[model samples]
Each structure stands twice: as C-alpha cells, then as structure tokens.
Target: MERIVCLLIFIIFNVVAQDEFIFWAELSNKNFILHHQNETISMAMTKSKNKTLEYACEITYVQNDFKEKMYDDFGVIAEEKMTKLDKFNFLNIHKNDLIDCFFNSKIDVKDFVKSEQTYVQSETYVRILPLRFVVEFHDNSAFIYYLK
Candidate 1:
C-alpha cells in the first residue's frame, strides 16, 4: 500500500512537470522554410483554450561545425547560392490570444555559424508552457526563455 501510494505520486509529478505543448522541426527541411531569401523557419501551434499570457524569451547561438556534418550525414543538399547571415533573430506571436504559441517563427543563423565558409542547418525541439518555453538542439544544448 505504501509503495503503491509512492508510485502514484511519482506518476502525477512526472505528468505535471512535462510541458503542455511540444514541437519538433528540422530547420533544413523545405516544409519549415518560410522565406528562402531571409532564411526563415516557421512552425504553427494551436490550442483549444483562448487565454493570453505574458512571457519573456532568450535566444542563444552556439558556434559549431555541425552544419557540414549534418549535410553529410543526413544527405541535405545545400543550394549554390546562400544568404549571408548577419545577425540572429527570433520571433513569435503572443499578442493574439487565438494563437496558442509561435505562429511564424524565424531564426537566423549568423551567431550559430562556426565560420563564414561553413553551411548552417539545425534541428530544434521546443517545449511550451503557459508562461515559458524552451528550445533545445540536437546536441543536448537548450535555452530557457519566456514568452509574452
């Protein structure tokens, strides 16, 4: 009986700790590309409840040679022409309560690029709560940011 109660408590804790919404996207995939010229990626989210929540967010760019490795390993082909990434930026919709989360997300690859000569690609996993969200990369690196 004691063990059963402990197990039930553990299950409830795990469920409460998990994010309400989780999204995954391969940034290099054409489906996620919003503007080829701008090198933008976008993902859509939906929720049944209509509630507005204010939050903050943090964007981090890690420099690495993962781009070349990603293309080689995943067979992702790069175009002959590439956009020069000058600055990294992130955008999401929070003003509209109808939108549960990010409507048209955009992420630039400038700060994330290791060098000018290397290509850039990323796989992102996003976990969203009512007041906060976390973006995690394939490398196990993550950033905790709040959204408004």
Candidate 2:
C-alpha cells in the first residue's frame, strides 16, 4: 500500500517536471530547404500572413540516390529514394523547452525569459515565438519539458 503510493508519487513528479512545447516555422523559397545528399526537409510556407500553408516539409525519411543517367559530358542524375532520418538530428524547438535546453546545453536564456519572449534554435535558424506563445512541431520533434 505504502509502496504503491510512493510509486504513484514518483511517476507524477516526473511527469510534472517534464513539459513539452511545439514549434513551427514558415517554409519560404529554396533558401529554406535543408538537405543532406539526396534527402531534404524544407521549411514552412504560406500565402496569407494569417493562415497555415498547404505543404509543410518534414524529414520523414532519407535515402541514397543510386540510379545513374550516364551523359556523354555531364554526370549522372543518381536515383533517390526514401530512407529514415534520425529524429535526434532534427532541430525542433518548443517554447517551454527553450529554457530547459539552454540550461541543459549550458546556454543562457535569462534575457529571453525576462523579456517574455519564446526562444528557438536551429543552428542557423533562431526565432522568438510571439503570435500564439505556443505552436506544434512534427511528431518526431517532441522533446523534454522544463519548469522554472
């Protein structure tokens, strides 16, 4: 009885300590594409500044391009196919998780926290969420939640 109660408490504490945040961005032109070899995961796109776009890119898989089209002067057009991309490599930042990541990675988020701005990172891409304070990311991007 007491052991069961203790177990339940432990589970609840861990669950509350972890929070999840969702992130999203617009996929603009070719500049937004992030590719490795033949695989690609593009950005968000929208026609209206108000609504979401039709085609949002996510790295569902990665594959090697092997089929070759031999040209007299030029190189082959190698065949590309679907393969798996590691979820850990994908950069998906959630609003709440920003502070936690910074702390875990030994980064500073004091300024953003004080300013009430939501911070996100993607190596070359860093943003602050303003409109909704919360957003969603690809299912694979869901990460740890933080408190304080």
Q: What is the C-alpha lDDT of each candidate?
A: 0.32, 0.28
Q: Output candidate 2 Cα RMSD.
A: 17.7
| Lowest-sum lDDT 10-residue window in model 2 | 78-87
What stretches of model 2 exceed 4 Å from their correct place?
19-148
Q: Pick the candidate with the highest lDDT.
A: 1
Candidate 2, residue 43: Cα displacement in angstroms equals 34
In candidate 2, what are the lDDT values of residues 28-104, reduced to their tens digit? 22233442211122222211234332222232222331223211234422112211121213333222233333322
Model 1 whole-model lDDT (C-alpha atoms): 0.32
Alpha-carbon RMSD, each predicted model? 19.9, 17.7
